[model samples]
Target: MPTISRQGTDFIYQQVTRFISGQISSGVLQPGDRLPSLRRLSDRLSISVPTVRQAYVELERQGRVESRPQSGFYVRARARNALMKPAPCRDCKPAPVRCRSLIDRVYEGIHRPGVLPFGIANPSMAKPAAKGLNRAMKRVMARAEERSIGYAPSDGEPSLRRQIAYRYLELGGAVEPEEVIITNGGQEALSLALMAVAREGDVIAVETPTYHGALELIESLGMLALEIETCPEEGLMLSSLRSAIDRHDIKVCLFASALNNPLGSATPDEHRQELVALLEAHDIPLIEDDVYGDLRFDGTRPSPARFYSEKGLVLTVGSFSKTVAPGYRVGWLLPGRYEERVRTLKRALSCSCGLLQQMTLTEYLASGEYDRHIRALRPVLEQNAERMTGLIGRHFPGETKVSRPKGGSVLWLELPRKVDGGHLFGQALDENISICPGMLYSPSRRYRNFIRLSFGHPWSDRIEAGLETLGQLVSGH
Candidate 1:
């Protein structure tokens, strides 16, 4: 075995992890193969045994290898199998959105209690962040002001906006408090952005197999959807987008700023800049959903599309629902050039976001614990994701392809040719397991064999059993 050396920027543990993972990926280390003893590896690599032990611990957390009681670490049988990335979609013209009938049923399953939740793209409630948020809510309620009970400004509370803007600056984006508009949730912010930019019968551009909510929003607004082929790793393809724009008059483009739903792809910084330029060249506005940006597995957060657009064409809608407090329903939008339009829409649609919730969130953010909370939350999410991915790899069919997302708590799956995601959805629910069928994520019924599974809930025997049931169902057992 080749020894580890401090030849690169990676830490000793990270280098060891890459070396072992690479070995597994190359099939040099077969399933159930015992890893070299810590002492042996330490001597071979001229490193400490503690470093080797740490690498093994990290690998176990990644679900690539597991420690057997009184035995050495062994490569997991499932981890030996490679997962394929989601295939790129082809260029297509704008068409009226045709939502699947199963979409409503899928959501009903997600909301229904007693069902194993692998459907909704929510944050893990098992984290301590929930308790922190609850305390914040109680604090606001204890000091209840008449203003707290009253309607807030349609644009949002100045304090909350300033806090959000400050957070934006941390991500290397220059946003002013006045540029932010608080909305009920990310969905509402997106709705306002859609309504602000396009009229009935207009065309909107979006990624293929995107968040189902976006497709529904487009349909509800009486707009046609122009599906752009998206990559599982890179997000929206600029070439596909440019092609679609050339063929059709795309009124506005709605995309995920990072960790897009379903596929969980984060558009890189350079790609984001290109996207901004593309939208600016066409003079079309971009509405970006960045709810998942903060949930990145990596500690560093990605920049919003607003960071690159000099023309101020990127309207970013984000919510604490995915990160901080779901019930709080606190979300905000930096509408860029359309700030006034979104503010006006906020007044016309609903007076404002809930005042008490906004106050609670303001206190939470001001406490300066929000960053600490997220830093702790990200690892839990990452471990959960790894656990789920391993489960899927082990249980699902050999032909199954799953996304290995760098961030986000959801996993996108493409099952064997014989499997039907809609039927699987129904079958899984019959077993009290809820999974999002792939058809709902797209305007057309393209990914009928695909599905999205959430690791937002804590991992347990119940979740394991639910996944086993899905694997059996997929295998037609």
Candidate 2:
């Protein structure tokens, strides 16, 4: 969605190219992974078949992926050289959060007008998604009965719950409609899941440089966060997780199942299976934040850890915010064995989410437009991430190390240790640009020399200028 001139002839082709490149960098398209057939991909992304072909040809030219006469395009094995995985943090003990003020300051600058938005993780509202949701909302509003404006069932609108469960079927998840509890957003779902399994003063295992919101919630709830080292591309390091498990009484482990923030790592299928087994062995519950699971650039969605939890120990949380509509504020939780407890918590939290929003999303899903919109959206996101990473590499210091995420819209950068991330944040803000300081991502102030940049917005000359300014600032201007 980066600001491309609508008049540009190669807009669609460029989108496809960036999407494929992002998939390659982010590990969504593993080495030698075959890409979708042109016809299938064109149908899937709702672009012209020729556009997909042209994009693939372009990728071949760049050596990002390759093609054969009979076989389809496969990600070139050499493309792996572009991705650099950061060394995992070593401290595995629980650390009390102390970055509240820094987080609040970063968020304050995030929505300020005229500032380059390289801070928030969610994508900019694309036209197709906006139009689809709007159409659905108008239809629902016109047909609404008096009940449509009243409080929804605490478990959420039945139709919406059913649609959520059905979508999970694609991921091989066995969520029943009755098990889905709707909440305000993924945040509420996570809060409910944590409350269902753990109490105050308990320790929760989390990925290093994990979602700041999770750390904030844990701090607010009087819980301690045991930080586990996570790989830049593959997500949580299971060995570190196990070590933390042995060292601390981790009541619950909260992690991203796909497209983790900042690092943009997606755990492979094998890792997901092993992660589930490890936690289940210790009788610990796992809360999986899968809000970004649907935005994979590889065009093939990865299954969440909850799909592997046969013993009902995995609580899966997701939302429409990241993909469809953030303003809708609609999200759900598959509470596993703690359904009743989560339902009670939802009722206690806000009674119910906005009824009309839930109804609108249900309508949107039923119309089968969600698939078309997601297909289009993922390519745009991948394109944006690809461009942003390239910009950072070209403009930032040569010693900088950046993560090549398989999906998601954020890039994590490890700058020279001499660089001060806090100062970089202040300088960027002074120039009307916003970025997330890496220290805020950890409870123990790790990654102080790093920063997380969001490529969720459409690219533009102004964005390029901002990056140039950031480069200058980072180089001690």
Task: Give the best candidate by lDDT.
Answer: 1
TM accuracy, model 1: 0.85
All candidates: CA RMSD in angstroms?
6.4, 8.2
Model 2 poorest ten-residue lDDT run: 77-86
Of candidate 1, the 10-residue stretch with the lowest lDDT total is 79-88
What is the C-alpha lDDT profile of model 1 across 208-302, one tens digit per residue?
A: 77899899888888898877877877777787888778778889999884778878788887898899998898899999899888888666688
Backbone clash pairs in model 1 (N, Cα, C under 3 Å; residues 3+ apart or in different chains), count:
0
Q: TM-score of predicted model 2?
A: 0.84
Compared with the true structure, the alpha-carbon lDDT of candidate 2 equals: 0.82
Q: Per-residue lDDT for 276-332 in model 2, tens only?
A: 999888889999999988887777787878878878899989999888888888999
State each model's CA lDDT, in order.
Answer: 0.82, 0.82
